[model samples]
Target chain A: MTPRIAIQEESFDLAAETARLTAGRQDVGGLASFVGLCRADDGLAAMVLEHYPGMTERAIARIAGDATGRWPLLGLTVIHRVGRLEPGAPIVLVLTASAHRAAALESCAFLIDWLKTGAPFWKREEFEGGAERWVEAKAADDAAAARWTPA
Target chain B: MRVLYFAWVRQRVGMAEEEISPPPEVRDVAGLVDWLSGRSDGHAAAFANRKTIRAAVNQDFAGPDHPVAAGDEVAFFPPVTGG
Candidate 1:
C-alpha cells in the first residue's frame, strides 16, 4: 500500500495526486477525499499556518498509520500546505482508498478528525487594518475526535 | 536538549529554537515548562496560560507528566488548530 504524505508551500494538484495513488492499481473500488479550505471572514486578509518542521510530518504520518491499521485501506494520501494563504485557498487534502466504500469513508473521517487535533499546525489570522491573532483550538474539534476513541 | 517553540508561543518567547540544560530535577514536561518559565519574561508570558500550551517530546504528543530526559527534542506550542 502506498501512503503519501507531503508538507510544502506549493499548491497541490488533486487530480494528479489521486491518479498517482490509483495508477496501476485495480483493487481500489472506493475513494474518499476531503479538502480543507481557508475561510474568508470579515476583514480577514490572509491566514498564515505555522508548523513544527519534523513534528508535523511525523504526526500526520502517525495518524495515517493508525487509520490504515484500523481499516482495510489500499492507499492513503495526505497533503498540507503552509505559509500565507488567502481565503478560499486549499489548506489540506486527505484521500483514502479501499475495496469498499464503508472502510474508505470511515477512514477518511478518522484521518481528518485526528489531523485536526493531533497535527501540530497553528493558524494565525491576518486581518485588514494590520491586526493579527492566533486561531484558538475549538472544543468542538476535540469532541469530534473523542467520539472515535475506543470505549 | 533542544527546545522549540511554534506559533504564538514562538512570538511570545521571541525565538524559534534554543538549547537548554535543565537541572536533574526537571524530569517531565511540566517540570520543563516551569523551569523554562523562569528563563526570561518572554518565557513567562508564553507559559502564562498553561491551558493553552501543548507539548511534544521527540515529535510525539506528550502530556504534563510525560517523562523527559536529556538530549530530547522538546517542543512547546499552542493547541493545534490544523485541519
Candidate 2:
C-alpha cells in the first residue's frame, strides 16, 4: 500500500483507478471514496479552472502529507483536474484504505478539506447576462477545513 | 514585465495579461497593486475592494509583500475555488 497524490490536467477514469487500488489488497477492510462534481450556479454557463503548475503539486502534497501523519491509512489517492471542465466532470477524487472504516472516512474528508482551503486555485464562471466573479473565499469550504484544526 | 492575471483576477481586471515596468517601490505584489489602482479608473474600480484580492509570486501562493523580480510571472486572483 502506498500514498498516491496526483494533480492532473486530464480527466481520470474512476473505474480503472478503483480496480487498481483494490486489487490484491485482502488485508484492507475498508475503502473510502469521494468524488466531487460540478455544481450549477444560478445562471452561469461555463466554468474554467486555473492553477499554478509547480504549486499545485506542492499544495496537494502538503495536504496529503497531513492526512498520512494523522491517520492510520494504509493507502490514499488524490487526483484533481485543471483547465476547462463541463458539468458532471469529476473535479477531484480521494480514496483511502485502512483496517477500520473510520480512519478511511476521516482521512478522505481531511484531504478534501485541506485541499479546498490550503491549495491555490481559482475559477471563473461565464453567464449569459455577464460573467460572475469569485473574489472572496468560500466560507463553507473554509469552515470545513477549520473543523479539523487543533483546538 | 509581463503581468499575467489568472482566474478571477483576469475577469475583474478585464485583461488576461499585460506587460509593464511598475515604478520602483512598487516592486512587489502589494506595491504593484497599489500602483495599478492609480493607473486608470478601471484599475481603481477593479481593485477598489482589495479585501478580496490575493496574490502569488511565480505560481506560488504568496502574501501581498512577496517580492517580484523582472521576468517573474505574478498572478493575482481571489481565494481558490478548486476542488
Best by DockQ: 1
DockQ, all candidates in order: 0.92, 0.53
Q: Model 1, A115-141: lDDT tens per residue?
A: 999999999999999999999999999
Lowest lDDT block of 10, candidate 2 chain A: A127-136
Lowest summed-lDDT stretch of 10 residues in model 1 chain A?
A1-10
- Which one is best on lDDT? 1
lDDT of 2 by residue, A7-126 (tens): 777888877777777788787778899998776657666666777667778778878888989988778888887776666667889888888899999998998888888887777666
Q: By DockQ thresholds, what CAPRI class is model 1?
A: high
Query: Candidate 2: lDDT of A141?
Result: 91
Q: Go through the candidates in order and give the clash count of each.
A: 0, 0
Candidate 1 lDDT tens digits, B14-62: 9999999999999999999999999999999999999989999999999
Question: Which regions of candidate 2 deviate over 4 angstroms?
Answer: A1-3, A8-10, A41-46, A126-136, B18-21, B39-42, B66-73
Looking only at chain A, give the TM-score of model 1 against the true structure. 0.97
**Candidate 2 residue pairs in backbone clash:** none
TM-score of model number 2:
0.80
Query: RMSD, each candidate, Å?
Result: 1.0, 3.1
Provide the lDDT at A85 for model 2: 67
